[model samples]
Target: MRRLIASTFASLDGILQAPGGPQEDPTGGFALGGWMFPYADDSMDLSAAGFDGKDRELLLGRRTYQIFEAHWPYQAHDDPIAQSLNAAKKHVASRTLSTLHWNNSTLLQGDVVAAVTALKSTPGPDLQMIGSGNLIQTLQAAALIDEYNVWTFPVVLGRGKRLFDEGATPSALRLVQSRVSTSGVVMSTYVPGGDVQPGSFVTTEPSERELDRRKKMANGTW
Candidate 1:
């Protein structure tokens, strides 16, 4: 069985929308499009390059799929990223789209979680998902994602779509690798660990003696 990987670029505050360009997604009054452009560095290049060598197919949401279909096909053949994205078999998750214009594209029908779970069971290279916040949320909720590649930029966009939202089930992750870019981007790879173990450290009201000790310590009278 092949693994399912989700790769996303996000701000410090967890906004994942429109990291590519201004027009990429203007929904919900998101003004900070193309926020990740300035932080591109050699580390980012190297991280992207590693994925270039991997045998993989793409899983995208409707919006992201349309964006790639419009841009990648027209890009020069020598552009490595374009070539890889255009040539790879794309599986798009959408309820409205009936026909896909891009070559070798498949529309996932019915329950999104079930369809993706079935896809993960198939033999192939890793199934990669990029820049699909909605789709990623569904997958994360289902616990279907096997790996995550997150490039966390330094800047914080106070509001936007986040990679992990409130609806997502609490889960633990184990960091596989991490690196910091010259531009202050923190790139990290993680794999699902298990269920989240919730714990906290707090004490109830102190006893009389304990309170007296605390007061003495505060007043330097211990």
Candidate 2:
């Protein structure tokens, strides 16, 4: 089965909405749409991190798909990013959209989970989800995503769509690799590390000797 990877950008406080530009997503009156622009630098290699549509097929939510369809295709003909995105096969999940006009774009039919599960079993390149927060949440709840490449910027937007919302499954992650860009962006990669193992550092029930020691300390005797 092919792995389903999520490559996304988020703010310090976990807001992941509209890292590209202001007009990307303004729903809910999100005034800080373009908060990630200031921290961008050349060191944040998009291609090396598997964020640029290099070898994987694209899995996008309706909103993200709509955003890309309007922009990438209209870029300069020789633009590498546009070329890759324009040529790659896109699997989009949406309940309201009946048609998709982007090149090599197809809609997943019926039950999003079932469709995606079937897609994973079929032979194909690894699937990559860009900035589809809603889709990410769904897949995350289902534990369908295999890997995460989260680029956390320095800024914080108190209110906006986040990468992992409260509805996200409670699970621990193993940090496989990490690096910081010159512009203070922390780009990290993580993989599932089983369930969320809850632990505590609080004191346990004390023994008789421990209790005596505590009593002595309370009385300033020893």
Candidate 3:
């Protein structure tokens, strides 16, 4: 079975929307589009992290596919990134997109989960998802992703589409590898480990120190 990997560029607050450009995704009046531009460095290799469409097919949502289709194809003449994206097989999930004009692009039929599950069982290289926030949520809920390449930038956008938004399944992840970029971006790779382990530090009986602290707080003495 082929692995399904999801790659994302996120802010400190987990906002994954519009990291590329200002006009990318402005929905909900998100003014901090292109928040990642300042942190970009030549030393950071996106392709080395498997985000540049090498040895893998592309799985994308409607919005992300459209964004790539509009921009990548135009650069295919001289850019390697454009060439790879143009030639890669694209599996896009959308309810409204009837026709896909990009080369080697296919619109997924039937239920999204079922389609992706079937694709995973097929004999092929791993399928990688890039910047599809809504689609990521669905796959995350179903526990379909095999790996995650999450690059967390330092900026914080208080409001925007996030990676693990509401309705995402609560699952524990083990850090497999990590590196800090020169620009302070934390590039971490993780795999699903198991269920989340719940714990607490509270004790049934408070110690004398804890009791004194609580008493001081109650009396406003700090």
Candidate 4:
């Protein structure tokens, strides 16, 4: 089965909206767009994070798809990132958009979750999701995504769209690999571990062993 991997750029506080530029997304009056630009460095590997679309198909939400369709197609032909993104197959998940203009792009029909599940079952390269926050949340809630590539820049947007919101379903993620860029960007990959494991350390009563130990201490060898 093909795996679906979600790759995103987030702030220190889990904000993932508009990391590329100030014009990317400002729906909620988010003035701090392009907050990740200050932390860019050569040590960070974009290909490893699935940004170059080297060996995977692109899965995008409507807003992100529009942004990419407008920008990547206009880049110079020799641009490696642009070339890779333009050449890769794009599967856009949109409820309002009925058609796509970009080359090698297809509109996902009907229920997003079911369509994605069907695609995953077939033989193809892994699905790589880039900046599709809405779609990511949907697939994530459905437990359809296989992996998460979270590149966290050392900055926080006090108010903005977040990677994990308050409504996120409780679950566990296991960090498979991680690295830090010279600019202090924490690049990490995670996989779903399981349901949230609940625990507590507060003790309300002492056990028999603890009681015996307490008695021994009080008696002082009697």
Candidate 5:
């Protein structure tokens, strides 16, 4: 069985949109594109996360695939990042795109969840999903991702697409590894733990004040 890993760059506010460049994604008039550039430093080597010396495949959403297809192919073959991306097979999850022109790329068949599940069952290298927010949300909803390599930059985008938006299914995750780059990027790896265990800080039974507050909340009273 192959492990499905999702790697993404998020802001302090959990916004995952347009970290690369201004033209990358400007939908909804997102003026804060390329918010991650200022934090870049020599210590930031993403290959350490999962990009090097691994048997992996690329799983991408349509927009991300388009972004990569336009860029990675033009990079020099000697570049480690470019080499890995160029040589690895890519699977695209896009309902609207009927065809993919990128080399070594194939469009996923049938439902995204079912297809990805079947892919995981086959004997192969781990599947790495990169910068595909929409696809990531779908896979996350289905609980299909096995690992998450997240790099949280220091900045925050007040409004943009987010990593765990409202309505995302709740699940638990255990941090297996973590590191901080010189630029203050928090790089962490996590694996799905299980269902979210609920607990509370209230030590004893609810006091009359708390109970009344709960009642008011339930009744939608201010």
Candidate 6:
């Protein structure tokens, strides 16, 4: 079976919204856009190249789809990353958009979770999700993601939409790979490690005598 990989670019404080421009996503009064621009370097390029090399189909949310539709198609034919993105089969998870402008794009209809699950079971290349925060949250909550490629930048935005929000379905993951870029970006790959194992604290409960002794010590009655 093909894996479903979810990738995200996040700030140190975990904000994943609009790393491109101020107009990209100003929701919740987020003013800091293009926050990840300064750290662009060879390592970033290499990371993009690595993603392009995955030989996977593309899965995206509406916002991410719109962003790519506006830019990647205009890139030169010789650009490897752009070519890969433009040529790959794209499935967009959107409830409102009735039509897609990008080539090889398909609108995911019906229940989002059901649609994605059906895709996961189909015979084809792995599905890769890039820069789709809202979609990522849904896939995560459904426990459908098989792997996560997190490229965590060094700076913190302090506020914005995060990659992983609260109330997500509890699950565990194992770090399978890690690397550090020259600009302090940490790239980590994680795979699903199944359900979280519940464990109790190792320390024993304080005895009554021990508690009384501590109380006496505090009261100077030791």
- Per-residue lDDT of 87-189 in model 3, one digit per residue for the tens? 8999999999999999999999999999999999998889999999999999999999999999999987899999997798999999999999999999999
Q: Which stretches of candidate 2 lie over 4 Å from their true place?
A: 206-222
Candidate 5: pairs in clash: none
Task: Please give the range of 10 consecutive residues that has the lowest summed lDDT in model 1.
Answer: 45-54
Best candidate, TM-score-wise? Answer: 5
Candidates' C-alpha lDDT: 0.87, 0.92, 0.92, 0.92, 0.89, 0.87
Q: Give RMSD (Å) of candidate 1 vs. truth.
A: 5.8
Estimate, for each residue in 1-222, the C-alpha lDDT of model 4 and write its tens digit.
999999999988999999989999989898888898889988989999998888799999999999999999999999999999999999999989987999999999899999999999989999999988888889989999899999988996788998988777789999999999999999999999999988879567888987899899999953
Clashes of each: 0, 0, 0, 0, 0, 0
lDDT of 5 at 116: 96
TM-score of every model versus the real structure: 0.88, 0.91, 0.91, 0.91, 0.95, 0.87
Q: Give the alpha carbon lDDT tens digit for every residue of 92-168 in model 2.
A: 99999999999999999999999999999999999999999999999989999999999999896899998888888
lDDT of 5 by residue, 1-222 (tens): 888999999999999999989999999989899999999888877776664424688898999999998988899888888888888899999888987878999999989999999999988788998888999899999999999999999996899888888868899999999989988999999999999999988789988998999999999993
- By summed lDDT, the worst window of 10 consecutive residues in model 5 runs over 46-55
Q: Per-residue alpha-carbon lDDT of model 6 for 5-45, expressed as tens digits?
A: 98888898889999878888888999998898898788665
Error of 4 at 134 (Å): 0.9
lDDT of 6 at 185: 93
Model 2 clash pairs are: none
lDDT of 3 at 21: 92
lDDT of 3: 0.92
Model 2 earns a TM-score of: 0.91
